[model samples]
Target: MTTSTAACAFERKDWLDDYAALKTALEQRYANLAWFASPQGGVDLPALDKRTRRLLETAEDESMAKAALSAFVSGFHDGHFSTAGAVLQPKIAQPLALPKVDYSRLNATQACAALGYGPARGAAFSLPFESLPGTVLEADGLTRAFRSGVVAAPDGTRFGVVRIARFRQQDASPAACEQAWSERQAKGAMSEADVKPVKQAANAAWLRTLAAQLQHFREQKVAAVVVDVGNNPGGNDTGDWAVRLFTAHDVHSARMMMSAAPLAALYFDEQLDGLRQAQKEQDPTPEAQAMLEQSIAAFEARKAGIAARGCDLSWAWSEQRPWQPNGCSRLIDAGYASGQSSYLPPKAFGNLKIASSIYWAAEVDDLRGAWNGPVYVLTDGGTGSSAEMFSALMQDAAGARIVGRTSAGDGCGFMADAPPVVLPHSRLRYRVPNCVRLRADGNDEVAGVKPDLPVLPTEGENDRERAWRLLDTVAADLRARGAKP
Candidate 1:
């Protein structure tokens, strides 16, 4: 990336040799190099790669070497780290709302509508439901009903509600797979190469419409079950049965791991060839043929542990004392490697796809116990990635109760299928986070889901009166823990 006679563009020493080949491809395929060597992962990465090589040695051109390659991937303050081609992932210009305009004549996605990026994804967070208190049984509540709605409480307790707005197509899609993904993106194909059987038939049609809306809120006996994912913005965290279909039991997921390199085993061998092209586009269901032969034997044991420790590794990212790979470490396959986690069972719980891509849904193990009662997710800060993986799996495997705030810190993304690091002289494109997940306090759901009850939203409050005053303070903390409401 460093040759220049100025034939075409990217001059400044070809953007500092594509920012030292994206800092040696994120220090040999990044997966949070032992959380940038811990101390609760403060992140130094060799002093942010020596201050982004002295900000790309005072680049004398190409927008300061693309702002020192986005300030060295925003100093790895990660969220699946970033970068992109043509234009996106380089916005930064927010603080200015009140009668504030002309942000240097706005452009970084309108100079920031709450932190913009690829379609400036921060705004839109509504589903009003005309001031709550019953009757919102769906009819376009965020596009024909995955917005179910309800709230009550004041000594009576009711609750129910729904609204996820995303886990990739938050529910109603199937128009012949959205016209075959708009005719394969008008021929520029690979919308994630047939997006996992078109999102395993839109997650088996939103787990049979969220198992008949959690069996119609346990026959309308609702006393708990909020799950809003407010301002959602994330999608298909392997679309895990959107937090194991609203709990009746068995939730336990997020262990996941990867990064042994060789481009993370060819990005999970292109996610095991898109699960062998969605098992040849149909014909799997002996429970989707044993969960697509156990995710093609955990993508062939994560491509033979990245080809028996596939070389090219690096660490000492200014060590605070963590880097632990005794040869391309970070695993998770010894058949769902227990004791230190790595799971997915209950018919590969949470949409690993069974009942083969919804032939009109239902019967994916009758969509799991379908609501065994008191659940509560909420969340905000525009929640993110698999909606913070269903708010950290409804606060650690469905005991639910998360309330609001502290999400959007983008917990775990890019699970399988990779191929977008490109940079050689401004071809741009970038990527990071080879895969992590964790979260059972062992941390690393990209450090996000934090609400045991944070709430926040008073000044001019409104998303339906701050989501019915945070689900009536979660029904007064479930009636001060007596909970039998």
Candidate 2:
């Protein structure tokens, strides 16, 4: 691929004198990044050194380089910071085309299908579909099948659903978006009181509405429950609420274990894997040999520590797994248990807010047994983080069949704070990822759970239509079993 010439030319200029204050402010902003020390409670000197050199060399005018490097280092899939400083990338200037319909506001799959989609088929007890590579679906042309529930079914077995496509707005400035979000929050798009501390009562209210719909299916003796999370960009408590609606009241919380030790496990694994791949090449460097030794030493130390704690070490034996170096990545260390849980506790002790704020109890007694029939969940690339966590828990605990497209496997749970870090010479600004997100199963190291049934929508199947198809399939299954529509 051809490299960027605009970036190279800009790097040649003496931008220091021309943009001194902006450079200074940028440097100051990223300084706090140093705080992200390695497992031994010290920053990896080599890594930091390399990163600093990269920043300085590209700081002059290579905006693309900066963005690429940031993304490379952070490991976050779509972190906005990585896109910063791009000088020559084409700006988005095309005339915008708003979605013809607001699928998000539609509560049922029948309504979504009316908008122009196919029959509903869920992850379980349903047929598969296809994908559309270069198509933009218009929302205004479809039928409307909505009534009172967030999700609906056209038949006893088929499941129909509705969800958000993606959040896209023309001319959406950061300030403007924040303002709009604030206004929406004020208007109760989520809850009445503060959205933070994730209100259980308010969350329950929303969930009860969904559960009531499910109850309708139950009353009709429907075979399955069609759930559409497509439009779900994911709210804090929304996924949690879903779990409560489907599972049993006697649910047990899965143990969650998190520490900096897994970092060594991941690092050594990557190094070993890279060497194994490079072993097929011509000559391996002497530096690579030394790196191998260091990685082995670190791996041994981490293994000993983790093993003493009775954690599983089988992951250490896996060979040559490709590694993604973005900072958001994780590797699961073995450990799993089954039981009942209404709330998740802190992995360690520091996260009091998370441990206490989340309430898992709800009106539905048990999701696994509540329906007394088949259960289905719809997912796609957008299902991530807590949503992924909720899905995994359901699959593991309640045996819910996951349908639609594969979920976004970006399930790291730790929150990233943007505190400022100061650099040594430039007095520059930077931020580093702190804290680890532990899964319900206790290991803080795994990517999001993959779907059991991976079904992609057809090329012409819009998201709304996909949900409806799933619902119809589920409804048909229910009717076949002598259930009412």
Candidate 3:
């Protein structure tokens, strides 16, 4: 466990080196520089740097040095910002010597907290599924009936409800995959070769099971369907697949980019490589072509910014643009066409990572309109990450109505495969989300997607009543919409 770099005593020279290394890494890897530096975040990194640097300089021992470093990162007040681990060498990073620190708990930084970082607003989406009549499929287990069926509206109309609690492929996988996974986990370590196909098979099963549920809804001749993501804490790209299943047309997800760092360049290159492979297999549809163009421009911008400002994003330190009155910089949009694209580049939410072995590039092409009918989604503050993503996509892409309240404002957090960035002296490893998802409104999803048909608790309304009222409202609207040709 003790290499030369790791074993370095907290001598003044060693301490300073660690501080400098950590500073350099943050400059390069921390993605929030643009947003936090802008008027939006108002984080005066230059001033904070001066203050923290002085603290580090005065430190005669390790404890003082740690405090100085923690203060510098803490100054941003972002939960995403924190120390990672100790570095043994140039590229080698390991876990924390102390417990891994989650900066989110600090809550000092207005960067996220002020912008709805904590509990989201509005009523919970706990609908009365138990109250439905016997004619409808009684939801049994998570699998048996796929946790779906029909709900009878008070006025004698019928509607379908599909409750998707989470988006993890492993969770929703087939029974066979679950058995294989159970067996695999029993072993000390999981081998990649054996794990991936099991997941893919399960994902295919999950999708089929869901598709079948939707088909059942269609067979029942329901006026519309409500996709309930209440209390749904987001997960992987299953959101992308789920959105595709509900609507016949292509639905564009949010756009995102990382800060200009080594990983940023790598991220863009890997994406381009994926695109190249895509081109090899099939012709570039207009959406793929557009995604390519926008992506290339973003890639070049990060390169140019890095070339101009170095890793610290120094260009924004002293009012680079009139727009940056707060003394921070923001990544300029790469001129995407019409804010809508037919295809989403694979891993658009998550690009390259050091931790993974395989990457899937197949875009969800099921435009067969799985539900073709009017679709409405139910969400609450509990809905976050990919769940919030589903809410946005269903509303923006499929023309589905989002009812209840605003979603959890997670927007985008850590991307796939969080390989740590260890400091040379301290060896403290850390990571940050290298990407962001921009909603169609030109705002980041960090500002939670607003519901189209907003419903909140009237002062005395109980949780149960609130849920029923929302359903009643949806039913009334569907009845009105149904009356049309």
Candidate 4:
């Protein structure tokens, strides 16, 4: 959104108390309170408090207090609710000028010149679309499934192009289902000795189909393979699996996050106390009390382990000290324990398998040597997380050219830290942002990855138009390079 303070509207007395209350809440959430109690631990609460106050007083839209407050809260950058519930989202401004282009040829040099800027003076000119090195014909029809103007090659035995517009849970392929079932059955029925042949056969069959497809494109003397990994919002790991047909590589990076101890403590202590007090009256039987005592012991043990880990959590969290809530001070075990709470938070693999598998495929096979064809990838704005990861890895491993706008910026990778919370008054459920999307360089900003050859289609191009532009450009480029289908 526009971070320009000049554009906002503000009034002096419109929301004085609300602003003050919001400021207090924010301070409590982020200020380092734990160090205040320690002899050597000094916190800069006063400075932080003063800074926050100043921001509020000077905020541009004091009349629209909620917006200013929310923006201020987001400034903390902790991925939590720093502002009040009244805040509204900000709007971002689009760029003033579009990139230069020609409908005829897809050459980067020509495209760059069309944009009015001089050629990237010092920038290296790698043929990003060259990732599709073996195809003779362009596969442009795959955009039907992705209505967001994705450009993909027509699925064929000779020259195949696949472009996923976004990651969607509803897009699981039947082939994926079959593969999962086969893996499960093989694991259950076959001994270690018998499993190898079965697994090999399955893998071989998959690779064979891919090999045949690549071979067809090779015969056509294709010159490139383009992958459009634009705004893919991420679907099943199968998306990565599909990418394997064109490239060889595996995703090796992994990321996971845990809640802060203080936060966890607050949740458990309050929740446990409530449970213990309720159990005392609801089920006064000796068995119930005994169970409660046992649960408390488990919680204590877990807390001790947590302390030992010495995580670099926030300072405010550290001061709470075995901070068990009222009734929960004695029995705070999680759901895995024999108490009321027994479930763990959900875990996501971030398409680890899919990533690694594709990397492996691309690394082992030399697309330039194997397929005499062009590859084109089509994507839009929904691609994120694992989808982004897939794109980054493919570009690194096979030089697969990207042919779409930047993807959604949520790919750094994240997982749900807590269950969805429905507000008592509004009945609206809110989820926490706990994942990060980063490139190999560790930059976790969003927008999306830029395309090598930027193509902004006319509105009339439609989804079909977008797809045709990518394929048509690639084919014309190939013919210029002396390749013929």
Best by TM-score: 3
Give the TM-score of each candidate: 0.32, 0.45, 0.63, 0.42
**For residues 1-485, what per-residue lDDT tens digits would candidate 1 score against the true structure?**
44464434546676778877776776566666666556666667678777777777776667776787787677666656777546445546885557634333333223223122122122223435436666345423343336575557556577777766666542344432444344444555342344545445545665667668878878878787776767876766434555556766766566666666665566556556655666664555575656666677766776776656544445545556543434344433322112112333444334533322221112244577677777878777777777887688778877878877887666665655677788766778876767667677776666678888877878998777776777678889988886542
lDDT of 4 by residue, 382-476 (tens): 55656765665454434466666665544432222344433232222333333333344433323345565556667665655455556666555
Cα lDDT, model 4, residue 464: 50
lDDT of 3 by residue, 45-67 (tens): 66777787788778866778888
Model 2 / residue 34 / CA error / Å: 18
User: Tens digit of lDDT per residue, candidate 2, span 247-310?
Assistant: 4443443443223333334533543454344334444356444443444454455445543433
For model 3, where is the 10-residue window of minimal lDDT?
A: 352-361
Model 1 CA RMSD to the hidden true structure, in angstroms: 22.8
Q: What is the lDDT of candidate 4?
A: 0.39
Q: Judging by TM-score, tell me the better candidate of 1 and 3.
A: 3
- Which runs of model 4 end up more than 4 angstroms from their true locations? 1-159, 165-170, 174-221, 228-231, 238-245, 249-374, 420-429, 445-447, 458-465, 472-485
Q: After TM-score superposition, what is the CA distance of residue 137 in candidate 4 from its true location, in Å? A: 12
